[model samples]
Target: MPHDVVIIGGGHNGLTAAAYLARAGLDVLLLERDDHLGGAAVSADAFEGVDARLSRYSYLVSLLPKRIIDDLGLDVRLVRRRYSSYTPDPVDPERGLLIDREAGAGPDSMGSLVAAFARVGAEGDADAWNDFYADTARLAETLFPTLTEPLPTRAEARALVGDDAVWASFIDEPLGRTIDARFTSDLVRGVVATDGLIGTFTDLDDPALDANRCFLYHVIGGGTGDWDVPIGGMGAVSGELTRAAREAGAELITGAEVLAVDPDGRVRYRLGEGEGEHEVTAGTLLSNVAPAVLDRLLAVGTADADARAASSAIAPRDQPPFSPDGPLDVPPVVRERLRQLAAPEGAQVKVNLLLTRLPRLRDASVAPEAAFAGTFHINELESQLSSAYATAARGGIPSPLPCEIYCHTLSDPSILSPELAASGAHTLTVFGLHVPHRLLERFSNDELRSQLQAAVLASLNSVLAEPIEQVIATDAAGRPCIETKTTLDLEEALRMPGGNIFHGPLSWPWAEDDASLASPAERWGVATRHPRILRCGSGAVRGGAVSGIGGHNAAMAVLEASVVA
Candidate 1:
């Protein structure tokens, strides 16, 4: 007899759905093309017996409904540590302004944020900062539950957004404009607005700017704030989920390869050693591959017309640079200079720093007692970050590379060997989105990548008293891989029509009417016009970081499906 559900591509979402269906007693079988599950969430052997999050994409959870964790008893594996925070004040010499909760950091998290904004010299900054975040916090609260909330009717959405102040924020404002108009200080304005740009490739000044902000709002960590890593490493969550999936009677296979699944409902696989093709079939098929891949799968027999249409119809869109063309663009002046985007794949980069110790603030005295507030950008301000974006548009990597550093060790050390965590060593993850891929055009060979990597490291040294390069352990050959998957022209590679991660420009035309058992939304029950498939995981999602939202959301969606059934 066919299994009740056959899930393909064992990424978190796929596994998550399988786990739910199985727990629901639905005889679910999840198959990953690769041997292991947690596709992007899996760990790798970078050193002898040392495993770390392979791509370590987004290493924190926010906007993930706590209820799901409780319902699935995930709190046992995913613990929310109190040490997640960051600073945006470059000139203050004192970081930790954004949200510091340690002893004497401030009256509270918001208070610390207000104080941090004040240092940047924004007039009316404190109250303004408080009001801003209070509004942001509320939005996170309302939309978070609404995410798992059943499909909303047009009326339901209007009513929810109407009463929920946070939901109301996204309606009319572009993220960048809102920041500049309200805050007097560029540092504060840039700092607050900076988040609106993270993970997105949109030009901040773009017309559809507010969408990223809404995406940002959906990602908040509920007092824990957005963006964090597990205590030891992201592998903890992956390891835990793999364990749970197995305990629940789900089989996980690694190294087994599946080349294709024909529409005839025959699943073909490159089975075990010295084996032949293996096949499996089920009454229902669930796929965890990117919506693109999933489209190909469901399109097999045209199981459902809308799913097939969506799969074939999906277009990959690029995350446009945050800046659009025109005056009042970058900087206060240069109205007529006429800026351009990085020529056809600019030289953007990502530099991962494995630290022997926490990165010290140039003035270390400010955060004397704090372990990790996530990170702070230094040597320059937000303009510097934006400047890289601007420079890359011309097809050249900004000489002094722009960067942001986050201390993962201190943020959440539970997953790591206590020995490593206590040893006071950490890894820093930084990416250069502004660098254009076209700049690679400058070199005939790999020399362009080398030059870019060296430049980023050097710029980083200039900012830090102790540069990360000093302690980088060389391999057996005494040669180092300067950057590890270290450089990617993301705008080119992942950007597709259905909306690329850059700027999340594809999230337009919000679909409220989700399908329910009572009434399905058109042909799609829980799917969307946008690729309902999530690419959000370490490296796979926005460059890299190992947070489990992709998995979490998939699981929640599965639960929602249960609700519908």
Candidate 2:
């Protein structure tokens, strides 16, 4: 019998969709090209003979909704860090800005900001910080709840924000303008701006306001936008999602490569290293892959006249009837738009280091545990970030790379083995910004990766009291137990076009204009030109981060579409 839904790609979003649909009594089948289930959210022993399970590729959890966790009964635990961020001054290494949630001057929560700002000798800065965040928090509270619902029209969403000034500052204008206007300190402005640049490569002055859209998603996740650490690395989250899907009767198949997908619900896939191809029929197909990937898959059987003519020759005997009523043929204008869509260029380099012990900081007053526990900013001053961005935009890596570091062991040591835990070993994850794919395009993969690794270590050492290289643990072969994945590496490994972690530049979560769409599915923004198929990944509207909003919305789209379901 044909499956009710065939979800391509076994990422967390796909798993979420599968669990929801299967629980609703739909037969769901999930296929992953990789041997592992999680697309980029998997934890693995990156270094040989290392006892640490690093959350390779994408890290941290902020955008995941609590409702999805509760509804799916996922057994993942997210632990919040008291210290939000600690940034060391490049000129005065002894003094740094530490935003501690626990330390405050008053009973009010704004005390944290007051205390942090006071430490930096920036009088009245706390009020500015509070005011700035209060606005974002308001929007987060109002906008986050609407993500699970149908996509609202632009005007409706604006009305929901209810503040013309807030909308103008955040949605209409560049986020940098808002930051510059609100914060007096360059360090503070840079720290806030970093949120807007996560996995996105755009300048603060970008006229398109792409940075603003990214900033909104970063700050508005889960209403509070707190990026908590998963208790047992990212694998724990994916594992629970896998369990949920399986328990709900969704059949997940790994090591299966989906070669083609038809708008009419036909899927062709091949098993591991096998030559014989298999076909499956689904009442509805949900694609958890990126839009570019889905487009390529659809184009496979319809790219040419010969292929289109032979399409019926390869049709399965028991194939379900194909529907021609929906937008089956890609419109010429839409095709041109797809072609013109800017390829997402990832601007971050990820470094996973197995440390013998946490590196000591230059600031003697700040304990190493406290600084390493939260995000440690390095060379991330506003001027530095702008300089680095400008340099990288012109195909040059900045000398002092802007990056942030976090030690997983400080928050959750469950990922480490008993011996490693007792030995005081920790894993440090560093994310360097402004090292876009274009900067590394000049060198071979190996050569550029080596150069990037050297640059990252140098950048880290610039802020530390001692050279970080001396503290790195050596693997069995005596090689440093450190690994780096560049944007190009992610592009090749994860099939992320241009190595973009968000799949593409995030789209505004609402319709631009009030136009009558054929169906509610189109209005929902999860629906594609093909009616039977829907996007359930980071490429979908309001899609990014670890949030399953896209998956939930995609499932809701199918469930609401009586014609498909």
Candidate 3:
């Protein structure tokens, strides 16, 4: 007999769906291409012989809802950063702006923000900053709660927001214009703009408004827009999900490469080395892979079916399971929608470094601990960021790379060993923006990685009292514990198309006014043209980052369909 549901890809999202479906008495089977679960969210000791478990690919959490955590009973703890961000002045390395959120609403706290703004020659930006975030906080409160429910119409959501001017600033117009009008300081403007560009390659004023969509997701997390560090690294988050799924009676299989997926709920896959291909059917199919990947699977399955119809001969042993070129056999509307999607391209460099100690800054007023505790910005003046984007768009590496650093150990040292913790060792994660995947056409991964690493270090050193290389810790291999991953590297490792971390471009959480919401899947924003299959990954509406919103919504759709039937 067919299983009730078969989830393709055992990432955190798949695990979430499995846990939920299994608990509801559905026979669920989850397949993971990798040997382990937790696709990008898993933490690993990135450097050999190092005891520190860095968040590896994805970092920080904001969009994950409290309801999912409570329902899963996850033991995850998120640490709210005391310092929001610290940006060193590009013109004067001796000065910087530090947002001390921990200072609270006291006069001293307000004065500290005002004084920091003045230090960077942004005299009146303090109030502007507060007002700007307060607007986002209101937006968050209005939209965050609806993430798990059936999709809301654009009109309904706009009505809920209840502010035409605020809505126009975020939804109708370009975010660049809003940033330009709100903040005076170049450094402050750049800091605010970075959120829209993280993992997305787009100009701030792009008429397409991709940046606006990206910006909306960034600031609407948990209604507070606060990105928190997961205690014990990201692994703990996935580990809990895996445990929950297993305990809930979900059957999970690793080292399973799904070769093809039929719209009729048939799935063909191969297990680990020396294992034969296997077939399974389910009443419902939940795809936890990217939308591009799902399209490929369906296309390959269609081709395989055609071949079987033409001849009865078995395929050659050495032949690849699927070819890259093919057209999907799904309904025309769905095929056209998939084809029209702009080819996804990631535009950032992720570097994980093990440091012996937090480096001191040229701005002596703030301690190294305080500056690095939250986001530490480097060479990211608004003008510099725009210049970097222009140069990168022309397929050249940005001069004086714009990057941000987060020291995870400061927030939660449990990711480190007792010896490393005692030795003042810290983990620094750097996200370098404006380096799009298209650059791979100009240079090899090794060449670009070497150049990007050098640029990042140089940028970091410009604001530091000493060179960052001086404090880098050596791994057990006796080599510098620094790892750089370009967009292509991410594509190869995580199966993320074009290395796009969101799996695809982000979408507005609510549906367009013209969108059809006739079915349970449609209302839940998890529907595919093929009724049997549904998306449960970042490609789903409101899906992205480390949040399990996609998985939660997909499971809800499946459950709702059953009830309707």
Candidate 4:
């Protein structure tokens, strides 16, 4: 019997759609090219001979909705950190800024801001900080819940935000201007601007406001925009989604590469290391792969064949129905648009390390555990960040790499063995920004990897009492247990085009007033021109980060169409 739906990728979004559809009594089949389910959210033993399970690719959780967790009955725990971040001044290493949530403080309390600004000896800084975040807090509360629902019109979203000045700064003008106008300290401005450039490769003043779109998604997730650490590891999130889909009776196949997909729900695939091919059919197809990949598969299975046969002495009327000029469901123009969608280039590098002991900070007053427990910003001044972006834009690596470090073991030690935990073993994950994919293209992969590792260590050591290398743990063979991944590395490992973590630059979540159509499918933002096919991945609107919004929206679209029919 044909399945109700066949999903082409088994990433978190695909699993999410499978779970929901299967729970609704529809037969679902999920195919994955990788042996594992999670795409970039997996936790693995990154270092050789190291027992620690580090979040290798994408780390941290913020965009995931509580409604999805409840609806799917997912067993995942996200822990909020008491401290938010700590940034030390490169000029005066003895003083630093630390933002910590006071004990028993409410989520909306501005105590952390007030405290951190006061510590830095900046006059009127607390008030400025409060004034700046107050607007974002309102925007988060107003706009976040609407993400799970249908996309709102621009007028409707602006009305909900209720402040014309706030809207003008964020929506009309560049985010860099807003950051510079609102904050006095360069370090504080840099901290806020970093949110805009995560996984996005544009400068702060880009006219398109690509950086602003990225910033909005980062700050609006979970209705308050606070990023939380997943307990156990990032794998726990994927593990729960896998269990939910399995329990709901969704069939999942691993190591099965999908060769092509037909608009009529026909799927051709091959098993691992096998020469034989197999076919499956479904009532509808939900693609979790990137749009470019889907376009290539469809062209190979349909248009290329039609062109091949047309060159022969075949009558037009006798041609197969799958021809471009025949009764194809999706038009050739739409297919071309999908194929020509802009490819994303990742601008961040990830480094994972196993430390024998946390390094002592230049500011001796702050405890190492307190500073490293949350995001530790290193050499990321606003001027420095802008300089790095300008340098990378010109195809040059910045002299001093600007990066942020997070110590996962400090928050949850369950990932480490009892012996390692007792021996003060910790894990440090650093994310370096402005190191675009194009820069790595100039050098061999091995050379670039070595250069990035050295740059990260040098940056971190500049603000520390001792070089970070002194505290790095060694394997049995005396090799340092350190691992680094660049944009090129991620592309080869995860099949991410250009190594873009978000799949591509994010677009506005709503249809414009001048849009050609006003239907729910357009408002929902998941439909393709093909009637029986849909997108359920990061390419969809409001899709990015670790959120399963794409999958949830796609499932809703299918169910709504079924009811209407």
Worst 10 residues of 4 by lDDT: 316-325
Give me the displacement of residue 205 in model 4, in angstroms: 1.3
Write down the lDDT that model 1 would get: 0.48
Q: Which stretches of candidate 2 lie over 4 Å from their true place?
A: 105-115, 304-342, 515-518, 563-565
lDDT of 3 by residue, 238-284 (tens): 99999999999999999999999987788999999988999999999
From the highest lDDT down, the ranking of the candidates is 3, 2, 4, 1
Q: Residue-wise lDDT of candidate 1 within 472-541, one digit each (tens)?
A: 5443455442343323433322322112332222232224455332323221223423222223222122
lDDT of 1 at 129: 68
Tens digits of per-residue lDDT for model 2, 479-525: 99999998888988888877788988899888777555457567667
Cα lDDT of candidate 4 equals 0.83
Clashing pairs in 4: none
Model 2 C-alpha lDDT versus the unseen true structure: 0.84
What C-alpha lDDT, on a 0 to 100 scale, does residue 501 get in candidate 2? 89
Q: Indicate whether candidate 1 or candidate 2 has the larger TM-score.
A: 2
* Predictions in order: lDDT: 0.48, 0.84, 0.90, 0.83
Off by over 4 Å in 3: 309-324, 327-342
TM-score of each: 0.73, 0.92, 0.95, 0.92
User: TM-score order of candidates, best first?
Assistant: 3, 2, 4, 1
RMSD of each: 9.0, 4.7, 4.3, 4.5
